[model samples]
Target: MASQDVVYTSTENHAGFKIDVVQYQPTKRPIEDRFSVSTKSSNRLLLGVYDGHGGSHTAEHISNILPTALLSHPPEKHAQIFRETDHTMIRAFTRDHSLLRPKSKSSDWVHHAQVVRAGCTALILDIDVNTLIASYANAGDCRAVFYPPVDAEGHLRQTEDLNAKTPSEQQRLAQEHPGEDLVVVSGRLFGRLMSTRGFGDACYKLPHGTIGNWQHRRYIDALSAVKESGKIPMNSQYHAMFHTYRTPPYLTAAPEIGTMQLQKDSFVIMATDGLWDCVSSNDAVQIVRGGLEQEVDNLAEHLLHSVRATRAPGDDVTILLLHIIHT
Candidate 1:
């Protein structure tokens, strides 16, 4: 059975704004998503959502580090910040000798390897209260949608979902790895990861032979242990990926950045793919519009309820709604 949902609202930032956040985990596996909201100054508000796969380590780490990193840098440097953070995590994982030791016990090595392999999609929104500018940086499939003034008929803006499934993303991958038709198979990178850009996932980004050598040594050690104990051998999921791996750095952490000027009757919705899997961008705006028309108590919770009533999310769901009240 699914665990209890996490729901809350915050109005602690600058005046004329209310933020509602909700998270729902529908599986037994650890919730692999993380989110944050912080006030950088009287003028700036930062919000982030990370959707993790393979494990939650990368998402958790990014959640803790990214907000401060973004607050310290200018908008132009945000993309570089993301790449640097990802590289930092990769370096830390690769240099940890305690995890890479061939003679180490299986559980220890496996846990470390899993941490290295984990990756997460990121969506960050930086709102400037003074300028009314909302800047967003995104990698992977996490999304943000802007709802225009109620009088403006049928106008909505949203971020693109950057995954191997998108044609433009596929073309970019094809260009990067020429003649490799298998670079994307069935909407997944190397027929495995769906996200084409994000943090961590060292197995996809590391130098080609790095993971291969580690896997070979680890497999040998596992075989030896199995022979001695007559136990089933531990298998690494990336073995097949290593066979087809050719290029280094197949995935990236560089985010696509965008900006919008907020106005009265406007709001923004930021969510992980779990919500998008069941609700389209247009539908999401409509749901929020209906909620506002009815003067719902909590917009985010109301939206989440609508989603659950329509179709249950297969993965962890996180939603953030920012209600813009012009002063």
Candidate 2:
């Protein structure tokens, strides 16, 4: 459940910039209208993919809140703002819930808590100076992708020195690490009924210790009770979101932040459940690099178009694109 922080090394020269933002929310049935935008700025650009859960309010809140945070803060505090946005959104959801729910004596706003509990997965990719920073804050299982310098042939390829798990790679994730089980375990071991980490769903997770710890502690002996105790039991039902919760927390906001530089050709993408449900990072990268030459701006928009055109429309598809300009 370690979630936050970033710093990137600058390349020798900086040159290109492109940003793409898109979202798909199934308001009705036949058509899925998601939010999307493409922008080309003088030097800096912001591309974000916020895949929201529970309600349109939460999805929409990310659309509203992220811009405000970016607009309000200077470059230095952007990471801090990302962390703060979770609390801010939860508060906003709580407030908005009041509008939908009329106060009742017995109701006590308990039923309406789900609205506040609704959390969004946020992936913010920022290109500032010569550095590229990737920040991922998720309540559930939204994903982000970093495509390193492509080959001379201009394919969206990467030699993974260090990067976040690709969508396909993450599918293979067997289990959580010790101390990282905040979101995996549900209900009381002895009376602790809740998740260990996350944002929004405050009803289950705590300001701290919501995700269960999964890291392997140094076991004292071959058959020590304490070390064996830390292992999550197989066949033991647990809540990932409130989807598995007994009473259900239904909210979360645990963020994992990572960074790299434009030493080579680099493109970073952030997306919500819409694309992640089907598309893999490598799959998306091929589309991004193949859509258009990296030399031009608007790669982000092109990427959105590519994903939208190809992906099966079972859910909303949201994507944000940031292309490194190596001058």
Best by the TM-score measure = 1
**lDDT per residue, candidate 2, 1-327, as tens digits?**
001100111112224654555444444432211232322344445455555443444455565556556645544565567567666644443443343554444343433343344434555544454444432333334555667643686454322211122332222221332233333333321124222223343434322124432111110110121112344432242233223333232233444454545544566666555566666777777878786565434554455555656654467665556555454
Error of 1 at 230 (Å): 19
lDDT of 1 by residue, 1-327 (tens): 123655334433356777888888888667899999877667788889999986687788789889999999877788999989888776654554335443346565444445456789999999887787888999989999988833356656889999998888999898988988788988899887898999977767766446446644443343233221333332434456556777767899999998888886688999999999999988888999999999987788788889888799898888888988765
TM-score for all models, in order of appearance: 0.85, 0.52
Worst 10 residues of 1 by lDDT: 222-231
lDDT, candidate 1, at 171: 91
lDDT of 2 at 201: 34
Clash number for model 1? 0
Cα-based lDDT for every prediction: 0.78, 0.43
User: Candidate 1, which segments miss by more than 4 Å at Cα?
Assistant: 1-13, 97-115, 149-153, 210-238
Clash number by candidate, in order? 0, 37
Residue 288 accuracy (lDDT) in model 1: 94
